[model samples]
Target: MSEKQEHASAYWKENLKYLIILLTIWFVVSFGCGILFREALNEIRLGGFKLGFWFAQQGSIYVFVILIFVYVRLMNKLDKKYGFDE
Candidate 1:
């Protein structure tokens, strides 16, 4: 492949890596904390609410937002690295 094509391919691969990692984190937090591990997490409390309940109702949303920001930052760095920032 040409150098430019190779760069594009690498950039796409890196982007996919970032997406997979972030989505997996989100899935674990939402599914594991909210359902699978709810009973275990319920033993803990945050601001008077059970941890698992909070994860189901609010924590997942918070995590998703945070992940959005994290993805933005990561993408910015990736863009710069790949000369795509322009």
Candidate 2:
């Protein structure tokens, strides 16, 4: 492949890697905490709310937002590194 093509491919691969990792975290927080480990997590309290309940109702959304920011920042850095940020 040409140099430009190689850079584009590498950028996409890195982007996908980050996307998969972030989504996995989302699934674990939303599904795993909300369902699979709810009972166990309920035994703990956070901000006076059950951990699992919080994760189900609020925490997951918060995490999703944070992940959005994380992705944006990472992509910006990646773009700069790949000479695509201009």
Candidate 3:
């Protein structure tokens, strides 16, 4: 492949890597904590609420929002690194 094509391919690969990692985290927190490990997590408390219940109702959404910011920051850096930033 040409230099430009190689660069673009590398950028896409890195982007997909980030996406997979972040989505995996999302899935683990949303599903694993919320369902699979809920009973175990419920043994703890968060702000007077059951940890698992909190995760089920609020924590995952909070995590998703935080992940959005994290993704934006990561992409901005990636874009700058790839000369795709303004």
Candidate 4:
């Protein structure tokens, strides 16, 4: 393959690893800690809000929003690095 193709492929491979890790963390924090293990987490409270309830109702949503921005920023950097951004 050409050098450009090699660079692009490498870039994608690296980025995919980051994406997978970020998604996994997202899933665990949102689903596992929030919905599934909520009762267990209820033993802990922060500022009048239960940990699980906060995660379920607000924390997860906030994290998701942040994740979107993080993805956008990362993809922008990736695009620029790969010469895909104009």
Candidate 3 global TM-score? 0.96
Q: What's the distance in Å from true for residue 59, model 1?
A: 0.3
**TM-score versus the correct structure, for each prediction:** 0.97, 0.94, 0.96, 0.79
For model 2, residues 1-86, the per-residue Cα lDDT tens digits are: 89889989999999999999999999999999988999999999999999999999998999999999999999999999998887
How high is the lDDT of residue 83 in model 3? 100
Model 4 global lDDT (CA atoms, 0 to 1): 0.90
Please give the lDDT score at residue 36 for candidate 4: 97
Top candidate (TM-score): 1
Local accuracy by lDDT, each model: 0.98, 0.95, 0.96, 0.90
RMSD of candidates 1 onward, in order: 0.6, 0.9, 0.7, 1.9
Model 2 has how many clashing residue pairs?
0
- Among residues 3 or more apart in sequence or in different chains, the pairs in candidate 3 whose N, CA or C atoms overlap within 3 Å are none
Candidate 3 lDDT trough over 10 residues, lowest sum = 27-36
Q: Write the per-residue lDDT of candidate 1 for residues 15-79, one digit (tens) a residue.
A: 99999999999999999999999999999999999999999999999999999999999999999
Ranking by lDDT: 1, 3, 2, 4
Superposition TM-score, candidate 4 onto the true structure:
0.79
Q: Per-residue alpha-carbon lDDT of model 3 for 1-86, expressed as tens digits?
A: 89999999999999999999999999999999999999999999999999999999999999999999999999999999999999
After TM-score superposition, what is the CA distance of residue 61 in candidate 2 from its true location, in Å?
Answer: 0.4
